[model samples]
Target: MHPPSVRSERLVSPTGRGYLQLESHPAGCFRGVELMRAQVPAPDAPPARRPTALVIGSSAGYGLASTITGLVRYGIDGVGIGWERAAGQRSASAGWYRTIAAATIARDLRSNFVFRNADAFADSTKSETLDLLEERFGGVDYLIYSVAAPRRTDPRTGITHQSVLKPLGEPHTTRNLEFADDGTALLRDVTVEPATEAEKAATVRVMGGEDWSRWVTALAGRGLLRDGFRTVALSYIGSPLTSAIYRAGTIGAAKEHLESTAVTLDALLAGFGGRALVSVNGAVISQALTAVPGIPLYVCLLRGVLGDRFPSPVEQSLQLWEQLTADRPDVDERGRIRLDRWELSAAVQATMAERWRSVTPATLTELADVPWFRTQFRALYGFDVPGVDYAVPVATDLPWPGSPAR
Candidate 1:
């Protein structure tokens, strides 16, 4: 008689469909689930997937998530647009971090991806990008515009405008922000800043869609954009509380311009069946967003309401991909694929407003909780990268991709 055989079985999810697997590491369990849920194939090349495109700012947050969605969810080999060099020697601006992470993820996923690391704001960088496009895939089918910066320099005027977060109207006194050394909890006091007219104007000019228009025009001029090509840029519309710092503030002005720029670009691309859309996304906890006044409290408050329904970067990007690829005849007169309709959902916003009312300095400590704040803050910079050991030394010497165009 044979010795008693040992067997083990574990329930699993593939293609996000339910299955059972025997003997898998606990840490790796999410693999089967994520793969199935996201719908990436094990053998790869199951069906002819949509031709991939180029994504600017494709290293972290929404940009990174979009890149992954292109590969895993859509099975498209994508090129990320980024800036790898700067005037000064400060390594690892947010963009650099994004590019590095994108490269690593692309490699792991066995996707044919390339990082077109250059100053996207500069003509030289743009030329280099064109060269890369010519050599690599001949052309890109989609362009995701997710570039974010605090300043912009006009090549024509030769004037540089540094962006700021000061609110419009009178000297705005808002909460002061002080974070613990351990990056745990934040302490707030009423902070005040007087915005000069020039400061406000500079903020708008830098954040506005003037540059976005230039980019689309440049790409079209090069004849690099394929017919039926599309591009998307992210925008935001916030509430009254945030209006001082976000919506009605300097950033808000810029975002308004950005939205308008989309319409203009759509007209420009209409000839080739190309279009530009502005995605007015919900507020996410990005590195730059954390710097905004009152956003910390806003995030904490929103979290209580959004709960699990508030999508993560990955989910958001997946939705964006679906919007880009799905067969739909619906087009609004505004010429935008309106994700903002869902973003500004009445249920979500109503809940957020209620939560906002309940938050205060005294109650915040207990209501928000320390761990939640820490997690959100750390998540901003890819610090809590899943499956990566946080204790491991991340090299500072890594060449950062800064906006050399700035």
Candidate 2:
């Protein structure tokens, strides 16, 4: 049968300052997934028994990379849960296309991959996922939580919490990257005011470890946690350069709660021969990070300093998998996996700091890889991907191969 076809156009944000692209290219998304799959190295040997993994928020960025690594590198079967919109008059979200591409690729590789397009914060979604785990996979060997939502509704309270990107105490003023309507990257000083007490609490409510803890507790309570089951939540700790607005900011407060929850869950899982951990990942271009005040500038500078040594999201995910599966996982004193070691290296920091200190609007391109940064951001929405002809028409309403029929 002929492949589905629909004329999809490229759409960017009307304001140009916004990070979210209006539409995604299907062919580009598929090619991007293929490229990521190719980066996952094969396991050293076949496993004694096949494992199953479930990746919450697994349609994009680190979550998607982790899902691809689980299936492509370790030969695992898995389920990926993501909240994405279907195509209507415009097009489906980039995540929607990515999940479909991932599922299609997994099937080609003979892996049983399931994709659920629903709000993961809902109790109903949790129950459905649990049923799938019990019926299809028997239980989950790995649980990877990498959610990055701006807001979340509390299933029990029926209240919605929106996360903000502001410092906790005083207002933070920093250099930020802004894009012009003509696609020029400009350096501007942006000041972000401190979040209110209620906002901080709400940020924690939306982005903190509460949901992760809930998910783990629910799984264990349902008798679905297998022996040696491992669960990890993705976190980040950037350099002191962006600390005021990032690592020491409102989001950082939420991450602190998340890390603490890992410690608590670790103790709870010990009885089942399981463990919980938080993996502090490296700085990589992602849709969520693009919206943060100071991260784009920091990441662009870091990329310029690291150059070829910079680790992509997929590369970091592979490293994370290796660390998690090791007999004695390498962790810091706080028992958190350090995937940001390279990005946080003293040499890298020094170089990036020097560049940051000297960088100006005129020298921005010379000091940082702004072009590459822009390309990466565009690629997140399935544009500028290599080996894809965006000029040709492609399908936008592609069905997710792993989703059950209506």
Candidate 3:
């Protein structure tokens, strides 16, 4: 039913020169999951109540980390929803392998874990997930919305919306990183034009809070929300260096919509003692960010400025869980969690800005953690993970062990 075992190799651009990785290594992906899970210490004591969670977009990046943290640290049962390709002629998506590894760990910990490899934006996917939650867990106590997509098809309207990364008022010119065929890093100035009104609207449709609201609405309509239910959506507000291209751009407009949705959802859930919040997370290397203009440069520079203090996706997710579960959750004036406080500290921003002004091809290595950035980028697709023997052949067509609706 699947392809034979093969030794996975790193594939790049069709022209053989670019930052895009075209293939995934299952072994490395499993190793990556293990590494992240290792960072979360087991709870000192069992939780007061074992909660059930539903993690949308829960296969990679912060979504995956949050899943692992919830399962391992809090002994939470979960249904993780992610859209990833199963292994075929090429390899399964890195997220596919990560889900398998996570499922294995959950089994060992005696936690009920279900993974659904289906479109999170579709009504069918939501219905199927809700069915599983109703059948197995009674209802969901926590909902984590961490979807990052280039486009989304509105299940209700049968219309598709694509997201764009462009500034609002004027074109933004910034230093960007380009990799040579030999993987040498090069600096170049790239100019990104402003998004049209239609494009801005499209971006909000794809990346904004509409889908999150829909999910919550669907769950509420199905009577699947447990008492004291809590929901969170991940967001980012970067430093001024990339603000024009990020926080002030089309994505920023979408984030504003997302934040406003949180306010509405909080009010909607008030009767159940539930809350909806947006956690402004720190910048971390993610597949979604790599595709965005100027984010790579900003993240690299941020890492260099923070050095060892830079928080990983898993670390930040663990901290987020602690805060959300606290008796008096720490939140800003807008009722948003601020996990980017370290990255946006005055001293960190000042140093990053100074380096940004003088950074060039010659000084990129000195001013930014280029090597770390590259490694992290590769790790997203299951490459360069420590202890993974790439020489060995791996079966790419592994199936989810106990998924009910895959």
Candidate 4:
């Protein structure tokens, strides 16, 4: 019997093995991807063939931020896959507020962007992506996987992998965080859940290496990758205090699988001279990370550290773009990209670990926001609303940074 990973709908590509097209919601009467598709290249734009890229989970948090960075920093016209209404409340499927915010920002810059609402984890979504690549652009040079979800059933095996965030092998209690209606100060309470072996496996199955491999294999089969084409996925290594709930816990197993997949993918793509990387990114409040076992406390702690100097998902994404398409090499010794390298430095970790030893639920806010950590947390979800006119009723119908002409 096939493992639970491969048993899905066997996403097939009837269209050329490239991108996917989405059902345009015309009745909404909103201008979105259409406006962003036609802007001419700026005179001072970097010299090169127009690079094409695709970012899955491109609605909120790191996903959305990365899409904007790709457009504003690099000239890579790309497609964004996520479930966001053009305007509405922030849903787990798609945070329309962030979508609109990103769209508004993209418009101000006259970018080429397209948003496709799809469940990126599914075989159907893969097929749709293939269609989009074929019809929209000839192919893609880069693919970014930043999906965050709970469960996935292998279409082939019908085995469902359900994700969980709990302490491993211990009945640990964590403070449950609840934000007030005004999104001001957070309230905390003790919460308990013992992560079982099944939960660990489920987390790995849902967030681990298999689907990523599938994506690369499918794309390579269709000739979507360009010369020296690249792919990247994000990972994290938090302080030891949260390690039990993060890297060493259920999600850690998934990351272990994911990191290992990079090497496997390198071998698989050896013929194409393409490469895959696992970027060790800093912690940020994407919809996905918000619900993790120990993330809220960690986020609060890390936010207190970075202060204004920290990087937002948008900024981190721009840095990531520079690493991919630019001549820059900002990777660490391990050849993996490191966005939170400095902030998570040996000195910082040592300090934070020491601080965590004495930290309690009462002191979370006080200790979470060191100058370095503060900036990092603020950068997670674009919460530090800058000079942008938040008062003005903004709309998400802005230019996409890297979308192709329809």
Candidate 5:
């Protein structure tokens, strides 16, 4: 009899290969976790002082990559703040498992890793972060804000704000994709509805920079932010194919607010010789990208357009982290950091625009790489890592970060 093979949790099955056979159990997934670990670039020589970095939303995506890179590269002690769901009867979110792997790796590397599993927007969580930093790492010099959420509740007024990914004023039609129940990808044109004024405000509230400002302000007020601080908040500016729904949409307004708040933080941190920067990352297929409507199709087209030049979330984070820590980075005229150079380059954008304009439903299959897009989508959920032995059982209840060691 043959051994049981692990089944993919993907919505669709690949007609081919190049994707990790996802295991629901975390223990069976260590190979992929370690794969991410191996990619973090280490520095030639460690820093003179043991620096501390406080990364908000540090469980998965860019935040997770940033924290892991800092630990491996600069030998920085870190405090990661996240609001991830705990593992339930079956399995937890990928972020939860990634947190487990991150904590374990940090301990193995002998780096101080403090995990804060709470809502970053809440005042109580801020207080807790401040208290923990005071008790453990003393004060943090690098503050990385990478929180991306669908909704947020105002702690002061108890009002819940949710974000939408529609156009700003009028409806816009765009070519997009939808997956069949059996996982067959189909191309279609979607007319995204416009956002109302209230919806726009709500989007800003949920995904904007107000909360980021509060964090820096509170940290500075409490002396939690050390001198010579550098705080970064990650944002995106994609191709014109997604410009309407992504760049000029309601989320765009939120990102504008976020960039504006970076300026605010920059001015505020200047009092202590600190700086605040907003890094414009490329159009990555991160969790946030997956959440936005109409992005999947663009990604599939982009994959075809920028063959062999696309960078994954891990690659983007490693590049940004290295530039920020070690080398002089490229910045735009507004003093904002520019990490999307490759994405927004003249050649790439021109080709993307030409292909986007020429793309059609009948030609989409030939023009886009559907299988690769599916692989990336599955990889986001920790489903598609290479060289993992799926036959073994993986632990689900790893000690929750910030819990007492038993």
Candidate 6:
């Protein structure tokens, strides 16, 4: 029988995606069923009228899901910007496969689609992306900024910044499960320390909306934005149990800035009827969120409330797009969309409260949806998807999404 555990290294930004395993379902599980359902767009969609868009930080999670939604659902003549590694001899990030799959589907449905594996925070990358938009599609009507990273090097200041997941003031004492190095559901509890003032500032520097503002201003100046262009970035505000580390922590500060920046950008975009809004999105399993300190165990606890019923990134993105496209889009008083309404509903919170009181290491496996959670986790990497034969040889080296000249 196939072993439950497989040796795998933790992926980090510095080394890129070379160490990623592409073999059996144990490697990444590209053969899962949910992935196929999400990737396959609704058929026979109406034609797009030269609709163009530019998406930043669009490799995985809500960003990648939004990319698929943009191409498949809206049939936008879209270009995606993300930092990704090529599907080399033995490895590639899940985003690479997702981009390929989405781009192929877009083409099949006669939707124009392209992607670039370049840093979105860099000025040079943005310039290159602008050129692609000019060459392929005259201008973009939508700018989707969904970047989530652990670190960012500021081009202007020449300062390297790293993000942290620690609480604001005091150390947040809670149960956390560190996964086994062999890539299994196996876990052990550990406590995370609080972050220093410097670390919090650094986290804000990397995760804040400053980079997002730069892109909007640059594009607006270059006349690359179409009339009524709308840009949205994702954020999260969930239960208070994880507040100390997530919502009220350094990342939360960053998200607050992100939301405020939207207000400023809205003014900047008013001239062209273009609007910028921050969508307080739900917690979805993705590369960046998975890497957060307290989020894993929080998700496991959340499983007790929302099991297989929990929404996927694709679902979240699609709902967001639909709401924004509606005749009267739903938005909060601050002019921001709340796509996470379901996650923070009264009923959900009630369940969360009940579960948090009784859940423990002993009852966690039984009370929580471990199998369902594991499957969802594996699905992020495009693994364990039904109908995908893991034993068969996969054509890893698909056509590159970059190459602005193309």
Task: Give the whole-model CA lDDT for all candidates, comma-separated.
Answer: 0.62, 0.86, 0.86, 0.62, 0.76, 0.71
Q: For residues 1-406, could you state the per-residue lDDT of candidate 5 as single tens digits?
A: 0111233332222222222222244542344467777887777887798798989988877888888778887787868988876555445566777777787778777888788788999999989888888898778888889988989999999999988898998999987766665667876777889999999999999989999898888988888878788888999877777889998999999999999988888898888878888989877667678656667877887789777778767788887776566444567888788778887788877877777787776777777888788766766665555665445445454456557533
**Model 5 C-alpha lDDT versus the unseen true structure:** 0.76
Candidates 5 and 6 compared: the better one by lDDT is 5
Worst 10 residues of 5 by lDDT: 1-10
What lDDT score is found at residue 60 in candidate 1?
A: 49
lDDT of 3 by residue, 1-406 (tens): 1222344434321222366666787778888888898999999999887899999989988899999999999899969999998767677788988888888788889998788889999999988888989999888889999999999999889999999999998898988876777768888888999999999999999999999999999999999999889999999998888889788999999999999999999999999899999999999998888777777888888888888989888899999899878766799999999999998889888898899898988889998998998888888887888997677666766665564332
In order of appearance, the predictions have TM-scores of: 0.79, 0.96, 0.95, 0.75, 0.90, 0.87
Q: Which stretches of candidate 1 lie over 4 Å from their true place?
A: 1-50, 84-98, 108-110, 176-178, 182-184, 192-194, 329-335, 338-343, 382-406
lDDT of 5 at 115: 82
Clashing pairs in 3: none
Ranking by TM-score: 2, 3, 5, 6, 1, 4
lDDT of 4 by residue, 248-354 (tens): 77888899899899889977766777778888888776557766755666666555665565565656776677677654456766668888876678877776666
Task: Using TM-score, give the best candidate's number.
Answer: 2
lDDT of 2 at 251: 91
For lDDT, candidate 1 versus 2, the one ahead is 2
Task: Show where candidate 5 strays beyond 4 Å.
Answer: 1-29, 326-329, 402-406
Error of 2 at 74 (Å): 0.7
Instruction: Give the residue spans of candidate 2 off by over 4 A.
Output: 1-3, 6-17, 403-406
Superposition error at 268 for model 3 (Å): 0.6
lDDT of 2 by residue, 1-406 (tens): 1224435444433222457567877777888888998898877888777788989999999999998888888877868899998878667788988887888778777887788998999999999999988999888889999999999999999999999999878998999887877788988898999999999999999899999999999999899899998999999988899998787888999999999999999999999888899999999899888888878999888878878888888899998998878877899999999999998889889988898889999889888988899888888888888887666767677665554432
How many Å off is the CA of 369 in candidate 3?
A: 1.2
